[model samples]
Target: MPAPRIKSPALLVAESGADREGHGLRRTLGRFQLVCFGIGAIVGTGIFVGLSDSVAQAGPAVVVSFVLAAVTCVFTAFAFAELGGAIPVSGSSYSFAYAGLGETTAFLVGWCLLLEYGVSVSAVAVGWSQYVDELLHSLTGLNLPHALAAGPGDGGVVNLPAVIVIALASVLLVRGVRESARATAAMAVLKIAVLVAFCAIGFVAFQDGNLSPFSPAGLGGIGAGTTAAFFSYIGFDAITTAGEEARDPRRDIPFAILVCIGVVTLLYCAVALAAIGALGGDGVGDRPAALSHVVNEVTGSAVGGGVIAFGAVVAIASVVLAVMYGQTRILMSMSRDGLVPRVFEKVSPRTATPVAGTLIVGVVFAVPAAFASLDSVVNLCTIGTLATMVTVNIAVIALRRREPDLARTFRVPLYPATPLLGIGFCLYLIYETGPATWFQFAVFLAAGLLLYAGYGRRNSRLGRGGDQGLTPGDAGRVRQEA
Candidate 1:
């Protein structure tokens, strides 16, 4: 039999090593842009839409759930920062797996990420509909028709606004990365300002009685809530997907990752506290629009609710932009490796953007946002993310052993402890995702394996021995000085 193929770490490094000096895509992002990407990716639906579900699950102790999720994210974020600094590639966990494990493992990670980012974009798009409908109702005294404003499960024939927003984001991304980053930064500022306004106003109306029976469902409830709240932290890894575009991938990627996680964690904890305190946990759950409901309840005014609804609409757009951006870049990376079609890897000479990939991603998620119920997509994303987390932590440890001499801009503290705990926490969350999710995930994995067998394994660049170990290329003129 022919030797079983495995993508060596050297090959993985060579692929990203070619990223310097404008090998394929344009490098336009700085550290601030990177931080905004994470913030934009993270602070949307989970707070504006999903918070109510978490509140319902844990009562007032949803605060504990947010904290638990943040702590877990911190562990995984450290591992990601370390790996991203070393490899500095667009594939995020997929690239990390390819370097530390094998090609098969890398393909599996990429497959999981495809679902994670694509469904997340759709889920956030569906979330945007909630706020858009609320804003319209507040201003025009008319709600969008159920058939046009919601998915079938939510009693609507289709979600028109969700599809519209995805289409708009696709146009923006096709324009270029700098343009997308600028828009993301502007929206990030607007959403953060709105969230601050909410906290400020909510504190004035805070009621102590609302916190009574804080852990209404006990520890089990808090654990369950953490599973949902964890979704809030999903986009921090999107920062790592910009390694090729980053001005200084090693130093900036790690810094941006840590900053985004720290800032978002604090914001989430505060928002959870303010929301439960102002509206009461029970009052917040299942509300058609959670943040708007909180503002309306506390201020006794519809204007504040209207303002919040507008901010949420913008926030969800930023999320769609950031998440879709991450997805397309990951597809591009896989394509360059010959794991997928070369069309995905094609960059427009004029725009330096992946036009085909961006359009395809937009269309793929748009269909789901237009018709499918996405409550399941959120859980599916969490399951995929936990799996990525497990691989990332292991990749960190493996890289340390394999490349002791590699220059690292950041390292996970306490060595094996951080990654080990990261693995343990990810597994715990996987268990909490329930049996139904596992079955769905298994189906998804099986589909990915079939695709790999049919196409990827044969066409992979490593299989053909092309630039597998950093052979001189156009990008070799200006090497990164480590």
Candidate 2:
């Protein structure tokens, strides 16, 4: 359906109230830094923790899954580039829906965004715990007890490291965005470096035979693998949320989205292929193993794997930083619109960061990380991101028709065809996720809808969307409309 062009007062993107203008977060990050953030977010979990699940779901066919998943994202990535360029705001899909699809859709999109960034942050925390435990056991021959290190799914009492990581990231977010991004970029380099080293070491031990029987379950297996593989791709989209803060939204943002995805995909494929090569099929190396296990098996030395485990620890911190930063930004956008409570939008006067929102979101992630099943939450995160991408694809088409003359700095190529392909890819993955994911998503959306109707609808600036308050660009747009 074509979305209505929303000239709503609520849609005037509020200042990222924390930063100073111009030199502020508004277009401050360059392409390289933006790409690093994307990599920082993408390279961690999908490689370190998610690989086992990808193997379980798709077996040797996971390589196929990676390709399929990357294909799907490439389509959606194009649409995101276009939309991110047009709107260039922090809300990501929420802001996109506001301008192109109106307040209600914007509300729901914001809710889904919450699911994508928030739950994913929790999931990353769970992943963080696993690596921390791995590092401890290998280095010190002593580790946190199983209860404190593992999640419910793993029959552990709690994931304390996960909680701690969340807490630490919260502090950084409260510090500020640019500061957090720099820290995350440094950690991201370490994570990639570790993985690259592992890949190089394992590559020498590669056996060509492992490539045989690649598609054990054929396309079905590969499809499942692709869906599973897609989980790692989540962080690349989060980079789009930095649109408002980017130095050049029209050029840099699109490059970041695509370039980041490309970089991560290559890394994942290399890591997966290298791991499989170093360990034979049905080997203990392929069992319910952390990434360190694969490294250990190939090297015949636990020390190398121990280093990989340490690398995993660094990777998790990077993941938490990128994911938490995305979460706070989206919430800031929501708070500004009065959809969520207003206090969340408050920026720290000193750091110019949304300290309150960061703390709240940090605590929210901590709960699940401290107590919930990592595997289960990971699935939830997958569904939320896929669902949002579907919305982005739909919104891309809707906006093009509704505002034909709107200055789109970057447009999705091949007319509607590219985004339509993106929509199809997104839906297939959504279906591939099957019923349980759908059920959870339904409950999440329903709950969000209830909140929207009860609070957001009444308080929405759209209903009385008369120029109440606006900055210069926003005021100009309003006057032009009037």
Candidate 3:
């Protein structure tokens, strides 16, 4: 016989030599550090730049859209909470799906996450560049040449600052998670501070007239804005990726995910309301209708706009740090599972961090950051990530059926109903974003599927009795069929 494939219903990829051989490391993460990671990742992307985009799409009713986004995330967060408690692994739901669904399904989940994380880094970096460029002009009255500051479509050869930020973030990831979380926390604070300032300054000039055309595009605008604003919920899932490192993942993961989503939604609503109040509801939607310029009209000086701009810069810095951090961990998890090159699985002995894995991820983000558009990249990020959330909702159902006996630290509050709602909401968001974004998402997912067919299927350690090294109870871990 050529071979009798040892099919594992669970999607867990058995460890290969690359996994066990490379890590003789230690654990350094605690609840506080992990919380910082959640906060860092959650705070950046929307506040810095997407704020204008959401405001434009939803009009002043973007606040209502934010509530919708938060509500949707809460439903999924419940599903994630259940999984984090049951399967405290890195890869988030990708790992959970492997153990609950099957290898093929797990591969898809992992692929979706990679799509989310990879494109997210690019989106964050591009946003960071915008802020950095503005901060530079404000601080020194001399900014980078427009050619260097922008992407090709914007008349630039390369986005120098975006690449630089991505490069720096990669270096930080290679160091260790704790060190990274500290930096992220600091940046998160500055970003939030800037936003609070926006609220204060923008509110002073608030006019009742701005709320007149609350839904300029009608209720459809609110729906589209809610869909567009789903981008803000992307980073909350970063909470679960740290399951292994968290001091009490069951409690911490659920808490962080929910808290981050809630907090971020509040921040986004504040910024949206303030911008609409000062800019007449439809103002500050696009680059030409920029948030800073609108603030200038009300505050009468660049100081207010400068503060928000500065905040955007600081916020994006943390985003690059946090998203890059999430990206490295996802690769490390896959590496340990034999889905990718072994070097990516290697963790540093001194720092107990995935140094090699982070370096490779760094290179991936830097290239795109050097060339891509902030708007396109961010939307592309949403399609893939929202797809992953869809999978998590599915995985929640699969696991309930497959492993009812498994310990769950936190259960989805409404069982099947909650997860189903999550799935529906995610799909709706993807639909409103348009067909083009989905096209890119499809292309990226197709690439991942090809990689899995060509490499993952053959190299999977479970196909080789490689996971027998796991603890006795964990021996049948990946094969617990539904």
Candidate 4:
């Protein structure tokens, strides 16, 4: 009657068990696969292509920026881990908000996730195309025509390689979660190995003078570099999106998240140090394939560069696969609650995946990857992710207060302080995005709210009195399923 503001944690838990007969997503992912998934998603375009820009912003002090960004993510990751264990659902932060915040707030969080995961898939795919062209030229001394190699805004007819990579990732997702996990695991290993090799080669040429006057632009430059580096950490939280599909989500999701943050942080710092030490900030320049360029410069061999380019290709592809998987699952959760079309909720019994939803995401995002410039949209993605993370941090506090005795496998060490810091850090990063990014994010939120008012509010399952029979006690009984 009052606009279905909230859904009790118990009801959400009970509803998760509705697929006991196996019509929903299958729980084939374990701790190892989830770790790989997080790694696969986190170590892509940001390191391969975006590092040069961060170096330019802060000189050699980009290493410190990497640490600062990781610290911000660590705070939010703790909040995510705590809630992820308590409410293991595919909707992730959206579902957490629905239970602790309200239906409208949940819809908005889901809308933000659309920007974080859906647009991210296209953005990563576009980055992948550059590496593909690099690798092709290295191997065959030939390259894709400009018209087929870049988005129209980049002076091309269409980005054919970007579309192809998205299509490939979508097909893997439609086949089944287990198959996708295996492919991701393989690529994850390859990419990590490649990064390790690059670090090794770069360190051989390390010179102390290259790292001198590290904070060339002082605090201001470091802060800007941190903002640039923060985008590299975008996919670590994606581990929680596998809640329904994790074999023991309550345990595995949190573990995978923490491990992912640690692994990615160490790798990023190592790569940043090695690149800056070997060539200095000026040498890194502003190249699209920064990592490969560094390796070539250090060794004076195109072969080394070619290998790094191949790794970037694999790394970006894995991000596309893992992030696209997260996007479809979130949409499926939204559809289940009648906030979107029912087609998204349909699962293929044979594959045990959301076939329709995955395909739709692939097609919708690929168009932007093919035809539009993503320079501005990348900032939009960063803002959307930060906003949702702020919601997640608050949702952690709300759920703790609302469900005081709810069984939780993991708990934030400092309770209110941790989530509070997470919120502050997220908001600060959001502020650093500048006025133009804020305007774009405001428009995105306005469109989302308009859609919710027009359709989602009326059709929500809770608004239809569908939760009448569910009670708080039901949560304890269905804890394992959740």
Query: What lDDT does each candidate get?
Result: 0.87, 0.77, 0.73, 0.88
lDDT of 4 at 303: 88
List, residue by residue over 397-458, the lDDT tens digit for candidate 1: 88788767666778899999999999999899899989999999999999999999999999
Q: CA lDDT of 476 in candidate 1? A: 36
Model 1, 158: alpha-carbon shift in Å? 1.2
* Candidate 3: residue pairs that collide: 11-98, 12-98
Of the candidates shown, which would achieve the greatest TM-score relative to the real structure? Answer: 4
Comparison by lDDT, 1 against 3, better one? 1
Per-candidate TM equals 0.96, 0.93, 0.91, 0.97
Ranking by TM-score: 4, 1, 2, 3
**Backbone clash total, candidate 3:** 2
Q: Choose 1 or 3, whichever is better by TM-score.
A: 1
| lDDT by residue for model 2 (1-482), tens | 84443643223444432222642344458887888888887877777888887877676667778888899889999988887766667878787777766778788888988777888888888888878877888888897898888777778877888899999998887777778888878888888899899889878889989866776777887888788788888878778788767776657788889888787788888888887777754441234335689878777887988899889888878988998888888887877777888887776667867787888888887888888876687777788888888888888888788767655667788978898898898898889888988999999999999999899877765465643555666534422311
- Residue 16 Cα positional deviation in candidate 2, in Å, after optimal superposition: 6.3
- Candidate 3 lDDT, 66-151, residue by residue in tens: 89988888888888877775665677867767766666677777777766787788877777788777666667777788888778
Off by over 4 Å in 1: 1-10, 16-19, 472-481
lDDT of 1: 0.87
lDDT of 3 at 74: 84
Q: Which ten residues in a row have the lowest lDDT in candidate 4?
A: 14-23
Give the local distance difference test score of model 3.
Answer: 0.73
User: Which ranges of candidate 2 are over 4 A from the true structure?
Assistant: 1-5, 8-27, 284-289, 466-482
Worst 10 contiguous positions by lDDT, candidate 2: 10-19
